[model samples]
Target: MTFGEKIFKYYQQINVPQDLPTGVEVLYPFDSTEVADLTRSFYMRYFNDKRPRTFLIGINPGRFGGGSTGIPFTDPKILEEKLQIPNTLDKRHELSSRFVYQMIDALGGPEKFYDSFYFTSVCPLGFVRDGKNLNYYDDKALEEALEEYMAGEMRKQLDFGGNEIAFSLGMGKNIKFLKEFNRRHNLFKEIRPLPHPRWIMQYRLKRLDEFIGVYRETLAPFMPDFHK
Candidate 1:
């Protein structure tokens, strides 16, 4: 089967919970042909034959971005209006997403990042409280929920075939998850950690360059062709 077909089938196989106390949202951007148009237009290009052997995994989907658009860290305004990326999921709010977009823009935007890297999550689904999203760590049932999620990730990774490095978006949970995976299978060349862009933006905007400097150092061997 083709790569896209593998991903599409994987999406169908996952046992996403339909209902929960507040709600369980699993946004599948690649489900329908219409939505997959955007998936093809934007995300598909990020994982072509020439794409880099790196994976950028987040803790989970945020409400407005992945939760709403079904694409990791994708902002609704940017996806719908700017990139003309279509979405079937309803609109919502996400704060860290904009900062992530900004950082990507600074790092030469999607065209550049996607050329070498693809983004995803430890958990593809979104968790909500009264209505507001509770971050991955905030969810009380995350430990059990995440084990199931990691199984799905391993499946996707196996489909992708060869990945040299796995970059966790934050120094917290994503790192913990990936490190454990590395130990279990020895499947990755290296798994690196960086502070979440949200934390960088909110707490150290002035030191953005420094934070990115550290990140670059970690990624140096893999990003040899990238411009400084």
Candidate 2:
């Protein structure tokens, strides 16, 4: 099956739990018909032709980012302006998306960058609590509850192959979890950790270019020949 078909099928089969803890609201943007259609269209447009792609995994989506666009790390503004994928979702600018797009531009534009790399999340879906975005690791109970589900989603993506070395988007809890999980399940040959874009944009804003350079340098060796 084509990459688009595989991803669409995976999304279609995702069983988002509605029984998230009392105060937590799980955001399954893929469940919305419009968002789902747009996501599928985006994949069909960019990932239609089969090709090798390294996987870049984040912890989860954010309220104004992937939660709104159904595309990992993509905010509505970037979706429409940079990715050329029009959407009616709230047009909010997410720091992570902005950084990612900047890195993408430095690596080469979206067409070249996305063709060689695929972005997804450890938890596929996102969560919000008390009006703020929440990561799976925010609560031990929640993390435990979603462990199996996260593994299942990751395995689905692994089945597509070409995910030899996965990039862990967060160096803290995200990399910790990924390392342990990979050690147990042998998911990828390597799991390289990188500072999360959100962290860099928020905490290291003064060194934005430096971080982008780190991204470029780290990713250079793994890039496809054309990208080099």
Top model number, lDDT: 2
**What are the candidates' C-alpha RMSDs?**
3.7, 1.5
> Candidate 2 residues 1-228, lDDT tens each?
887778778787877854456688898777688888888988888788767679999999999888888889889999999988787888889999999999999988877777778899989899999889999999888887887778877888876555688899999999999999888777789999999999999999999999999999988677666444
Summed backbone clashes in each candidate are 0, 0
Q: Where does the lowest 10-residue lDDT sum fall in candidate 1?
A: 18-27
TM-score of each: 0.76, 0.94
Give the alpha-carbon lDDT of every model: 0.63, 0.86
What is the C-alpha local distance difference test score of candidate 1? 0.63
Tell me the lDDT of model 2 at 31: 67
Cα error, candidate 2, residue 174 (Å): 1.1
Candidate 1 wrongly placed segments (more than 4 Å) = 1-9, 12-14, 17-34, 50-52, 80-93, 185-189
Candidate 2, which segments miss by more than 4 Å at Cα?
A: 226-228
